[model samples]
Every structure is written in structure tokens, then in C-alpha cells.
Target: MYYVIRYGPAEDNSADLYMDPIPGKKVSFTRGERLGTLPLLTFRKRAGDRGAFLDYLGSSPPCMVVSDRFVEALRSVGVDNVDFYPAQLVDEATGKATPGYQAANVVGLIACVDAAKSVYTLMPGLPEGGAIPKNGIFEFKSMHLDYTKVHGAKIFRLFETTSTIIVHESVRDAIEKAGLRGIRLIPAEGLDAFY
Candidate 1:
């Protein structure tokens, strides 16, 4: 079984902080591409934001900026498919720097979604060819995967939808056991109304 990763709900009395790649900086964390010699990426807290920085910081386009503990936990579980690049998060309002975070890019792509069993609509002008849509947008209602095509990969982005990240059951167990904050796992079979 696999799961869809998401940010956990915010705690009461805590304001959520959204981080963005500082304007004018180049971002190379493309969907599932393996990066080499990444530029030092810097993120800034959105204006008017003041709050505690969770272990996982949220970003537009869904890049993973995680804490050292989060990195260690994944490493402890022998997950080698992910690459981490050094990153910094600064609050402009107070000039405070939140350290110990890195941009995590999960590598590899597996086009394994079971389109016949899933609910989705292809963008206009595209043919209903096979299980995978060719370079077209798929607005998914619910998603299911073909476990056979996964090839035992612990973590990967779907080729049909690179924006979506899937993790194996063992990976989810490691994260939960480590008590990592700011993360939520939705069963792959239960994905609906999701990005």
C-alpha cells in the first residue's frame, strides 16, 4: 500500500507561516528531475507572517522543506531515493533565521496509476488513449496505483502526475514512528479532492 503526503493541520494559537523562494532566486526542484550542483536556495516568510516554524515548511508548488530530524528519520529507514539540498528560511519582519531545514526532492518517476479504476478527467483536446495521458493535465478526483509497476520503489512521483508524491507503507511507518510534525498521510486509495 502507498500513501499521499500532506501537511498536518495547524495547532491552535499558532499562526501558519508560508515560505516562498526569495524573489530573483533560481529554483531547480523541478517535479522529479535529479538536480546536480543546486544553487543555495533561500526562502523567506511571507510578509505579515509571525509564527513557529514547524518541522516541515509549506511552499507553493509543493516543495518539501524539512528539518534535520525529518532527514535523519528517513535516512534511518534506509530511504535512498530522496536528495536533500541545503536551504534557509528567514523572517524578514524580525530578521530571524530558522535553521536546520533542507529542500527535499524525491527522485524517480513511475507511471503506475490505474486509470481505469481511478476517477479523473483529461484536459480538452487530448485523446483517451491509454492508462497514461501524454503531456496533458489530468484533474484527478480519486487515484489508484498499479502496484506491479511500482517495482518496489519506496518513494516516487507519478509520471502521469509528477506533482503527486507517493510513499510506500514502510516510509509512512518510519515517519509516524519518528513523530515527525507538520505531516499527514492519506491512504492512496482514499485520495479525493486533493491536489
Candidate 2:
């Protein structure tokens, strides 16, 4: 089976999830006319630009949930491998402006099911919650809705729920699965195969 994914935004009661187009705007994708109709399709939104609003968060947000403890006060509470369709750099020198900034190095895990893809977004933890600006990070706002309707590889975010430090999900899983565990199902995710 094959999985096609993209990072778009859909308005939610709490948060607006991004992985596809701005929702009801008739848009076309670079992939093809056929694949363009796919929902989870997303175009690459770059983080570095001349004038960026979201960039105000900080100069550089840490990439992984674990290690790289250079981030001032914000720490990694947990990490999840959000399945996302790789973004294509915009030609820039062209293209309009949107509210959100570009994609961060932080790997988001997107899942694929029934030829569709999903982004593993969760509520903002204490650290993430603290960073909430007058404008909040969409990731912090998007709560997984109708999770039962979504399926794909799952990445868990493990945070102390108190500290700002983040721990990688895979490492947490490894620790828990060590010593007294029976049968671990390696994710047969097609997202990994997409690359």
C-alpha cells in the first residue's frame, strides 16, 4: 500500500490543524491533478523568511524532545513522531502570506489510513502552554479529534507534566518496553516508506 501525505490546516473549535490547504479553498497541488484532491495534502511552508510573525517564538526552537538542552527555559516534556508529508520549498520571490510560519525542524509524525493521512497533534503541555503567545502555536491548540476515525503510526508524547524538558517518544517507549514486556509491534507505517 502507498501513502500520500501533506501538512494542511483545518479550523477546529479549539485549534486549527494544518496539513492541507486552508480547507475550503479550491487549490491545486504540484504532485498531480489526480492526487491534488487528496485531503491531507500540504505544501511546504518555510520557517525562515524576511518578515515572519510566528518567528517571534524564539530564534531557534529545539529540534528533538530529548538532548540539545540549549533552549533557554522551555524544555521538552515529550516527543511524538508526527507523520507529515515532506514539504516542498516554495519558489519564494513569489507566493502570498499566511498567518502561520514555516515548518520547524521538529519532526511531526503523520499517519496514513485508507489512503488518507493525519497529523498527531495534541494539547499543549505545561511548557508548550507557557509559550503560548497572543497567538498560540497551532500544534498547541489542535487536539486530536475523533481519534477513532484516524489510523496510522502513533507517536506518544511523554512529558513530566510539570517540567519544560521534553523526552523523545521512541526512547520512552523503549524504556517502558524493556525488562518486562511481551510482543512489540513495530509500526508497519507506510510514512517511513514514503521517503
Candidate 3:
């Protein structure tokens, strides 16, 4: 159930990819590096970072989920704002995407479901909300996991949350690999043209 969310250079000026988007950015500190690493399917949480291993790492405050190792790793790598609340908030919402919805967009929160599993997940996500762009997520090849085979293509409700992310489920296999190509611009940085 581990996943990676990374920020990459935008091929075009469609979406402005800012640094912090996931609540994890505000907590884990290492989250950005973790997400930026490529081939996420093979990514794993840093050793001693799991909830049960905290004691061996150090005596963290009850409120601190961000581990010392995580912070050091992020700092060493020059990345700040690794948060953990984004994933937890998804659970707080009880499988409905909203609690972690990004505010700027009406419905920024989403539940990315892997249709094969028939359930939404919180493990893998876009590191910075801006990398995901405010719109045109489906423009490129991304696996859309819809157990119900939702008919409304590129249309759905985005949940609401202060600690939010635009959750989307794809059947493509972690994510749909549409293959990088060209760019197209539109209001809200629409998907690259002919993606």
C-alpha cells in the first residue's frame, strides 16, 4: 500500500507546479523526496518511519507523526514540507473524498480508486497539488479505476478539505501511462494540447 508522489518539470506552461500541495508536505518533511523518486511502484517508506517503529527512532511527541529520520532526509535533500495529514485525512473522511479536498478548486479532494481493487486508496498521490494541475488530469494517459465504469469522463465531484488533494482513481495500473508528448494551454492551465 506504499506509493510515491513526485513533482516534475511541466512540458508546457499549462499548470504552475508549486512546491507544497499534500498535507504530508507540512509534516514528514521527507515526503517531497519520497514522492519525487521515480518508478513509484518500487518505492518504499524509509526504514523506522512506520508508526510502530517510532520508539526506536526517538521519543517523539504524541502529536508528531513526522519522524526525525524523515525530517533529516528531507532537509539533506533540500526539500521541505513533507506532510502526513493528507493520507490520514482521507481515512478521516471514511472513504469519501472531501476531507482532504484542495480548496482553490471547488472539489479538490478525490478518492483515487484502483478499479481492480474496487476501492480508493491513500498510499500513492501527487506530491504537489500543482503538479496535478487544477484541471486536465485525464488529458494524458492515466489509468482510471472505475469499478462502476463511471460514464462521466472528466466529470465528477471533488470533495472539500483544508488538507486536501484532488483524489482520482485509475484502472491503468498505479497510474495511466499516456506517454509524455506535447502541450496545450487553457484557463486553469488546461491539459497540454494533444497530450
lDDT of 1 by residue, 1-195 (tens): 899877765561223444454455555444677776665666677658755566766665467888888898888778898999887777878787777889899887788878778887777777776656632445778877889899888888877777777888888998889888887788988477434
The whole-model lDDT of each prediction reads 0.74, 0.26, 0.24
Order of all candidates by lDDT, from best down to worst? 1, 2, 3
lDDT tens readout by residue for model 3, 2-62: 1111222243211211122333333222111233321101111222332221211111111
Q: After superposition, how far is residue 20 of candidate 3 from its true place, in Å?
A: 13
Residue 135 CA displacement from its true place in model 1, Å: 6.0
Largest TM-score belongs to which candidate?
1
**Per-candidate count of clashing residue pairs (backbone under 3 Å):** 0, 23, 33
Give lDDT for model 1: 0.74
lDDT, candidate 2, at 110? 28
**TM-scores of all predicted structures:** 0.86, 0.20, 0.19
- Give candidate 3's error at residue 150 in angstroms: 3.6
The alpha-carbon lDDT assigned to residue 31 of candidate 3 equals 16
Query: Between the candidate structures 1 and 2, which one is better when assessed by TM-score?
Result: 1
